[model samples]
Target chain A: MLMEKSAVENGFIIDLSSIKNTSQLVFELSSIMEHPDVKGKNICLKLGSLDLKQSQLLSIKALIESMNAKIAFIDTKSEQTEASAVSLGIMIKEISSDLTADIAPSEEDFKDSEYKEEAVEERTENPVQDTNSQEIVEVHTEVHNNPIETTEGIEDIYDEVSAQELSEVIPSENYQPDGFGILAASEGLLPEETSKYILLDTGNVLPEGVEENSVNTESMQTLYINQTLRSGQTISYDGNVFIIGDAHPGSEIIAGGDITVWGILGGIAHAGCNGNITSKVRALKLNAIQLRIAGLYARRNDTLNVPYVQKTNEFTPEEALIEDGKIVIYKKLRRD
Target chain B: MTGRVIVITSGKGGVGKTTTSANIGTALAKSGYKVVLIDTDLGLRNLDLLLGLENRIVYTIVDVIEERCKLRQALVKDKKNPNLQLLAAAQTRDKTAVNAEQLKEICDTLKEENDFVLVDCPAGIEQGFQNAVAGASEAIVVTTPEMSAIRDADRIIGLLATKEEITSVKLLLNRVRPNLIKSNEMMSVDDVVGILEIPLVGIIPEDAGIITSTNKGEPIVNDENALAGKAYRNVAERILGEEVPFLDLDEPKGFMAKIKNAIAKLKVKV
Candidate 1:
């Protein structure tokens, strides 16, 4: 015996308990539509266990339409079946009413509805037109549905909608809502203690001469000398300087950053001219007549008491640093 | 043969630049090369005195530059070595008597006939020094082992590094006392070479014979038995592309051996 049929709102439901293929489903749907009570009415094919391809669903939809009756597929979880049904002007009935109600019209849903309305309007306006215009309409509808083919297309739609909503939601000129803006805003959103900790962690927050420091550090280069800087020879650089040989008494070295001498330094060494107090002057034998770090200076007499005892009165390596507003000379540690 | 013009200069006075020039020129002449020594000191020429050609100078380099005499006429022949000659400086004329261009012209003309032209530069880095160095293609900086002399030598080396035609600059450490160097009282040859940062051409030991040789108006290079003479000869041979080891001035002498023997006897008695 054939499977029993049931009644639904404005439609008849034909159970596919015994149907195995598209031909059998079509036969059962045709018989149900042929009934006088169901003739010219909408029908819902309730799937039991049968799974059908898009082509099969489309053919069944066409057959039901030829009998002057509308057709739809109930309990269809496959998206391809639903797409083919929609392309053939067939309806899809959701298995649960709550699920149908939960999916309210989103922005993309509204766009799809508008696109369908435009497609219907064009179809009705150009009915019985030439094949060329028919193909043009098909191309137009394909272009409209092109985004539904890939996952990136869905993200593109979401991004466009969120960008538009952001422009409308945030009325402040300072509050930009793009990725970079969000990143910048996050820094401001952090708590005061947290921001302070981050600043300390980076160790880039220098003192008052930040502009000069950054400019000097960015463009500064090192000058290397492999030979001695004799008396009456002066070398001035905008950055760190290194000399591999002795600097005699009358020689002079001026730099913006640290100055390092691998040999004796008995001349005048001036470093940190860009107001960087942290810059230092290091030498194998630091006996400079005058040493200047930033604006502070130290003469030879001022450094005479600094004990640089290495191998009993021989020249010991020393480093000069600006500390507490005065230049201080100290014996350089082994690691330094 | 085109000759190499070498300038012998010591930035400080009395560092034996004239003596080094005369000895090197004489040694080269003794090796059968025609070498002419030019005194660029102008008013204070001493190369003639060191070369024992002081009484024979009828025309000075100043007269040659002034167009008063031909360069060949101003060149005085060495009585001891015919291949060696001396172009003395004018005692009355100052350093301004000849400029750098005039000296270079004279050197270029002299180099055509001579195998070597050694210019004895004046003391300071003034016009005289400039006139001496302007004609040379190579430089030999003579310096004593004193700190003051080494400082001046360093300055001169720095200046010579700026010259385009000076392809080589070598150092000659003069009057190095090995005993004093061992006691750390005087600078060693290494100390001067370290500060000057120039290749060492020679090291002349502090010998008492140098004083007698200078007083007798004879270059010490003519004294074959003298230690300073052998040092100058080695320097000349090295300048002529011959490799000669430096003399071991710190070798155990008779006095050191005597002291060592006395110490050994005292140790035995103890």
Candidate 2:
């Protein structure tokens, strides 16, 4: 019975101490801590010689501050909490022995035991309540406390697998092989959490002011791709493309307006792509290929000598744009 | 249970899609899930032939969609498993013979009674593949380790991603040869996963039993002792959301295969 009392008291203490690294751990602790009977008893914290890092120490400090509890950190070499607690009881007796010896029969020795017993009685009398809701609130509170820390926590609230995190660990979940992470509870911090996906981080991956194009905007006239775009490559523009990218022989591209490929712009290319194209197609490297510009159609011209841009030792970003209703091509100036 | 409709598709042909669908359906049926395998191959109706149920199909899916017969009348029971059924396609029909809306409607009706509806998508990213995948809440893209197959799977995955309707699609690698994998002669599962970059549903070993089963109109997954059979069952379990660990494709050969291969190597050395 005395041991049961201590178990209840210790469980509550663990719940109140908010120094856990994982949400699962916090949940398990909260259930025990929120027990009314356990809360009523005096809880003891045996701070052994644990090498806790700053974050853990801070979290513990936060929990102690929240609960308004008295805690003393000791650097004892002992690993056993129960034995240390007993030793602590003895040490308290020795320190106060001279003063308390003349008073009521040793309240210090009985105090810890009485607190433990009361905690146990309270546990036995109370019914089990779901502490999951309390755990979630604690999780939010913890995240709110340290807005910068990203480590072991409720990795996901739903069965511990955030859909976004699930997407990352199992790359198959999100189907993005070129390095992508999932955004579980899409609080939109997902874009911020995964560094690799931050494609345009201010000082990182993407350089500053590299604004991504608005593909769906009405002003986005057309994309004129003139070079072979390889697999895993993406190019979006506000104007028409002249040609390129493996737009492999059978592939096609969609443009908001007229598209003209100077290379073997094969595959599917749409000018006035998405029906916005005052779209037309003119290809120098045109192999007789499928073409679509707005509602217009141009069959593959087998005789068309679409200029095949042969590989050279130079870095040439050949691109095309429309000026005054005609397709023009040139190499882009080096931004660097 | 309100059955889940799953479509098995590969954008390119010769990717073992039909074979994978057949095996997975058989495995799920064996697991006691009321399964209905729909052959969406249209004119190239081979799933029935793969299962050796070609002769049993009296009313093809074409007949039901065309209103020649009722959906119930068109379903052919798998002689092997009472819980498994087949909705065969028309031999004379093309992909346009059935529309995506029609297939979705058919799947909705089947989902009410069955625990799982497995659609065998025809090869090519044309209308047939679209029709088959239309109703499927989940999709499995079967591919070999070759770059060509991986490329096609990637395209299909991209399409699925852009599609607002279809929610989930997974990858299943078939015909993996462990011997070639160990010798760096073949693409490892990791290589394929890295390239296509989708959650892996299963990695089926290159088992001769698969060919033999195909020749005999038997599903490789029906052989209780076969490795590919176990692999398909693992895929089925994963579809049910069980965390089944993938088979270690790179593990050293078993004693039996090692001894046999050693003798073969000796012969080559001589």
Candidate 3:
């Protein structure tokens, strides 16, 4: 994922423009920092529109510093990262066009077309740069939209990266009011926490004597709970279970039918534990550590580092169900 | 040599038990000792990820207990240090898969060849914790500067008292923000030690470097200039029966300190 390694006057340029998520960026950046050539050298980071929290940016800065190297400056299109860099006293200087022109990474290296198109537009504004990048610059501007939607391919990306990064980006791009895609797969790729739930290799994690069956859950009695489920607390029902408050991590909810949580579900939710394949788990914020449906069990991805503290209060509701023997999550866009 | 098996445990979760285990284990190994770190947080393992040895794990403690793989094969060597090895916990199996007797047997075998066997116990005093403490004679109860963590650590110390095999149980206060303590916003190390009523082993400052080191899959103890790393190294020396003083956690704000830090970095580079 690290391309365009160039040595500057007294430093090295580790262009992390290709990688999208923070974890992958750090994962790759730390690996690059381990190389003897990059050690103790002033490092210039070209971060293309990756929104990072001040704490996250500070950790990146510390990671660079711990390697006995210093970050001379960073080039980013993200205001959050810029604010973070300013607060941390790290310099925010855009790599000069002349410096980048000599070792510019190809346009295809970018994962987000929205940001890549802007970078291309910058080259288009400057016609005097070089004849080499003019052709590639013209090609990027033509196809402005890149994959308007990420459909039936989340489980695909999970097949490529290692288990530590084994995750599918949440289908957030599909929440575009079912219209012209406002953003390509860019916004959904932030934070490197795409896969909210990863399938556990444990075969048939259901309790003993429970068999897989897709019964009509609507006919079953529903257990309603109003209090928040804390750690180690458990709620088990032979039918459906609906919770009005949040289910914190370490709590367990097992239902024979469907499980609906009005608040954030951050615990383990097992729907149709008695074996109803049609049973689904829905929550205002489906951040369950383990999502279980029928006999299939999927734990939260190891790298799903959701910032516990954020300014925005927006939470897109989500639903998880069994589709073709795989637990596929669908974005539940509110009609209101 | 019969290596001392020390279980790093905290009754409460998110109190940095695994982080302490990884760091102390790494620090001990760096001091020219044969160290074997065992992660017993089955189905929720993280020790491998912190050490950046996740990809190298071919088998786990479950595989060793079940005889699916020999104990020697389950030991994944660290990337930078051959003296540091890890026996990862199985991510697919729950805590019930292994019992206390089985864990003790594994620890006994591991202690014969290694100088230190650090068991990273999972949260809660359930079967997982029992299995972790089964084979250990020494314990380090890790806690943060919070009432909840201290309360849990107290309970853990009480539980460790009932074990005939456990000879020592020391408290290692983690995430001690000295500035916050100075302003009376957070608990001080003395207060924590008073409540827990255990011998002090180490006091780790809340450093942002830990977060980066965790994500990088390298322990902070590897970074010689990191204060947290230096504190962990001191903890290892204490484990080896050295009389080391605790670090002064006052936030360094002097210009002279800056020059000293810069000079230290320059020395490390050279």
Candidate 4:
């Protein structure tokens, strides 16, 4: 409803002003660019008042080019997103609010929506794309979530605990006994999320001379395997990786696109290893020791090391992605 | 064939690390595997003593690393078992005498000819521990049920995780007193495993025979009647990828022991 499209004689505009996060914006734009007619056409983007890092903006540019298309320019309301576009060398043409009503297309090559691109957002406002093919991949964000590292096994063995426990907080059974003493500590319970993982301070883990880019994850080839990844075994692939079994602790999985696991994912998983900002990692039971997305790396909280997890049938499917320059995991996967 | 290099390490001193190394090495050799036990404790070497091969050692590991003798010359063949050998540590030199790279080179060479290279690490996580671990791709962390030992094992486990080459880090609980655990005086196997969060390799019961074996320069695993020996043998089998049930420490077999246990229980009740 926030979009309008009036297809002028030339290239079109994509207005993504309503999207809340960079990942959603890129995900939606990539789906639209998958249209057959959209290939080879220069596109204009109307990115709303969302803050974007230089890496994020560059990834959006890469996503468009990956579809055989290009972004001619972009208009943004937020100074942060605008600054990112400028630093990335993307041209920014401001489409003023006053000029929206004054500019009308007398001849409609494509028409739909309330109002769309600036000539472009004005086009998306008139979205004639229903007659054409416009399938935008929707990323529905579910707000409520249980504890972070929630495992479902207490019912199988204990029998008394029926429900999936809210993020279980494990205290570090570690302490410095003396000047050089350990093997004992006072176990104190603490709030999760803040205690579970400390973001590794290694600055800009992306390789030197490498820029962040989002290759349409759906376009990349997916490697499928059914095996429990053991310690010391590493699976590194250039495309999406789909594991049908558990990734045990000490094992590592690195992929260029998304990482999806069918069972418990307890090892280190690096999704979008090539720095694609829109890539995600989802698992049936996601209690990974370390979660890495694009350029961000987070270690499992040392206090959360008590892995009393048993492999049972019940699963609390979880997903992890990058948001606000940090790795945020959502509990339930929502579809619309 | 490339042999597997396994390091047996315990952070706290006197946690049966040397005893576990000697027994497991002997047991592996008994299973017909060509095993070489590397005493990496350096200044405080004891694997040779436990194997009763200290007197037979003509050249130590330092001699080989320093290029004074060949690796073959330094490997002391066991008096009884030709399949088992010991690369005795230099008692005269300190831990600083050997670097990690030199130890890794020695391990690489020995592993080329042997089936299993078990490195007996020093007590602490110092130069000796690093030198021992540099050669190993697998690790067996030995710990007792004592709070101090379990704590130190946790620290050692964390340290082992940092090494990229060392893949499998398993736990071996030593000197587990079943009677004490029954009386709630000591931590049980479950408690230790829950705290450590690693797969158990084996659990050796506290046997007075280990003391005699250590004094006589013999591994307890060589004693057929010793429960500790059977436990060590089972550990070797498990390492070979055979699934073996853990020994129930409470179950004492045979008529004589059964009668003695019954009488002791009756006396306690009276």
Best by DockQ: 3
Native interface contacts retained, candidate 2: 0.00
- Judged by DockQ cut-offs, is candidate 1 incorrect, acceptable, medium or high? incorrect
Query: Which candidate's TM-score is highest?
Result: 3
For lDDT, candidate 1 versus 4, the one ahead is 4
* Candidate 1 regions with alpha-carbon error over 4 angstroms: A1-336, B251-270
A1-336: candidate 1 lDDT, tens digit per residue: 011132232344454545666556654454344433344444556554566654465445544544545553455655666665444334455444343333333444334456467545645764753552333233323333433332222333234233312221121232322221111111233322111011111122222454323244434688899999875577888799999988875467888898999888876787877776778888887766567677654444311211221222444467776545545554432231
Candidate 4: tens digits of C-alpha lDDT, residues B1-270: 789999999899999889999999999898899999999987677787677654345457888888876788778788678999999887656899999999999899889888999999999898989999999999999999999999999999999999999999999999888989999999999999999999999999988767656755668787777788889999999999999999988974332231122110000000
Judge candidate 4 against the unseen true structure and give its global Cα lDDT, from 0 to 1: 0.70
Error of 1 at A251 (Å): 42
What are the lDDT scores of the predictions, listed in order? 0.65, 0.54, 0.73, 0.70
- 2 versus 4: better lDDT goes to: 4
Worst 10 residues of 1 chain B by lDDT: B261-270
Q: Which stretches of candidate 2 lie over 4 Å from their true place?
A: A1-336, B250-270
Residue-level lDDT of model 2, residues A152-265, one tens digit each, is: 243323223233223222222222222222321111322222211111111111113433222433344544454675422334344666564445532435555455555444
Most lDDT-accurate candidate: 3
lDDT for A200 in candidate 3 is: 56
Candidate 3 clash pair list: A213-A275
Q: Which prediction has more favorable lDDT, 1 or 2?
A: 1
